[model samples]
Target: MTFWFHMNGVGIGSLKVYTNDQSGSRKLAWQRVGRQGPDWNQGHVRIDTDVQQVIFMATTRFHYGSDLAIDDIVMDPNPLVLTTVSQTYPSTASQTYPSTSPPRRYLTCDFEINLCGWEQDGELQWELKRGASPDRTSGIVDDHTLLGGRQYAFFNGHKAVNSSYVARLDSGQVFFQPGVNISFWYHMNGAGIGSLKLLQRTPYGNVLSLWSRTGRQSPEWLKAEVNLPPGLYNLTFEVSAQHHFSSDIGLDDIVLSEETIS
Candidate 1:
């Protein structure tokens, strides 16, 4: 099993992992008993015992208003394999969107085709801007982003106080196979008051969130990946801002692929 962990305002705390096997007894599998800073950390363990259950616990000796968050927990029975199916990016005006229907193949945008057939909300605001500028030259959407020739769709809360935007693709367009995964690179390192989410339209017409992130994460591009089951779904990219004009977000290098357990 593997997982990501984050902590905030923590002091004199201990993180421990416990496990129980068919013997019906508990034992400590792993632990981190000490002080820690607020940051994103990851952990993994190889359970040699026939573990019946696993437990994670955090104990604080003093009351310091601490917080802990966990995400991206994967417990696959077998080591899963991944194969790339498509990498979608439209660079020219004539380049068209890839068919959304079976073998779903395409990306959201590189900001070359002017949003690349993506529909956006007017209030929240999204625009294609040069990836590199005096104020925003450090963290770009992806490694392929050029200084002046390439651009990315960004939501910089320039004139808005509290903002929200929804960018979506209609349904019945892409055919996603079973065990396929979607991924993208995002830049969310501004005022630490922005959020980004990936959602999909269910068959019954309900939007379900697959993955999400909020606040500043380091000072560079980050990657978000979600494994999806076989289905025809409409994907949506949602962005929101809180407070001032410093909230900024960027997106690029969207990819969908199949996972084969090898």
Candidate 2:
């Protein structure tokens, strides 16, 4: 059995699931406590014995302590099975399996905890901030990753001097095949906003511009997607800011995945 749940608010509380047998014996199957942020979390449980009843409970300390939400409950009779093969091979022989491993996402970052292996390079640095920018004259009030409950990478234009200031967030080297897609959410709002550029740095010390946006955009978060040719390269998000407090910019939820086609 599997289900998706979300929890928010102040106080202390828990979301619990129980299974009761025909003999009136009840056992706790799954449980979660505290806040799980603004995004939905997945929970799974396996029951070998017959379940006569299933119970879902949400407990809170006070009226405004916490809130629990559950959705998309799924019950699967056939659980996952693991198989092992035993083989005796000669010393001179070898075995190999082609395309047997499971598919995986290349890179995913929300900046919820930290930079997720990204590095900062330049005169100015990008800050890991929550809620809103320090100046508060521009930028988003909440992060784009989880709306009201997450942190994002932000660049403050107020720190710029008489000359244009440049800040960069660089990703580690990633192998890109055909149909690889990169997507991210950004918030560019302010009076003196400058240009935001996405550059691909190749292994041979070559830099290629992929995508870019200039000037002030909407106050809300906007999404951007880019598709690159097959190669090995590092991704750099470079932002050039003018000298103004209102030229703040934000970035969140960067994902790199393979696009499936029919």
Candidate 3:
């Protein structure tokens, strides 16, 4: 049990003290916290132990791999020692992020990729299929290439499609609006990287994304959103093939909503 006065960060200023103790050295005694570690070596305290010593120990979690260095220890006397100088410093939490913001949205574009025919492409193409849906109900044609059908990455009268672009929906969807929330669910097998968006065609490039990270990935639901500006937008589930010849991705059920964001 000892006392110490921290001398770090106090700019050069006169410290006034009026002590009645006759023996100054016997007034108080202290053992430094961490005499090792980078900060401690730089005249800083890493830990103030329960029972301190010149050779103090510290437990830490490192984010990087590195060899422990010996010269990281430092020792110096308190420049502001007095009759009794102690400090009850910070312990755990430093700061916290705000928790009241809107939550993120994750949309999953489940493939009617089966709409094509075989399990060949894993339904990963943006192209349309024969007897697809709605439209002429005739030949297989990409809805994005059709008139007003561009709303779909692929769509028709039978089955609807959500695109990587602005579009509409049949049932569950973010329902593009100026003040709506959007998101997507995703499971990619190749590259983990691709741009997902809730984009406006007016500005033509307005966007949103669930993940920007790249690597191989498993299929899963991932959401993203955008606050539109008086035009149409869709919670588009866009993905790029991982050029590694590892095949394509498989997606599950996709859902978009106008629900409150987190």
**Top-scoring candidate (TM-score):** 2
Q: Candidates sorted by lDDT, descending order?
A: 2, 1, 3
Q: Candidate 1 — which residues are off by over 4 angstroms? A: 1-108, 133-148, 163-173, 260-262
Instruction: Determine the backbone clash count of candidate 1.
Output: 6
Q: Quick one: ranking by TM-score, best first?
A: 2, 1, 3
Candidate 3 Cα lDDT to native: 0.28
Minimal lDDT window, size 10, model 1: 166-175
Residue range 1-262, candidate 1, lDDT tens digits = 5566655454546666678899988876545433334556555443433799989888776677556666787674532122233554676444333334322322434555444334443344466666452235333444344445676666665545545543333222233556667667787766634678777865456788888888777567677778875565556687776645556677766766554333
Q: TM-score for model 1?
A: 0.51
Candidate 2: RMSD to truth: 16.3
RMSD of each: 17.8, 16.3, 26.5
TM for every model, in the order presented, reads: 0.51, 0.57, 0.29
- State the lDDT at 161 in candidate 1: 52
**Candidate 3 structure quality by residue, lDDT tens digits, 1-262:** 1112222221212111122233332211112221112221112221222323333222223323322222334343321111112344489555432222111121223333321111111123343232222222122232322333322233111121222221222111222333344344332333322322232322244454433434444433233343333333323334443332332332333433444455
- The number of the candidate with the highest lDDT is 2
Q: Relative to the true structure, how large is the alpha-carbon lDDT of every model? A: 0.57, 0.71, 0.28
Evaluated at residue 80, the lDDT of candidate 3 is: 15
Model 3 lDDT at residue 154: 37
lDDT of 2: 0.71
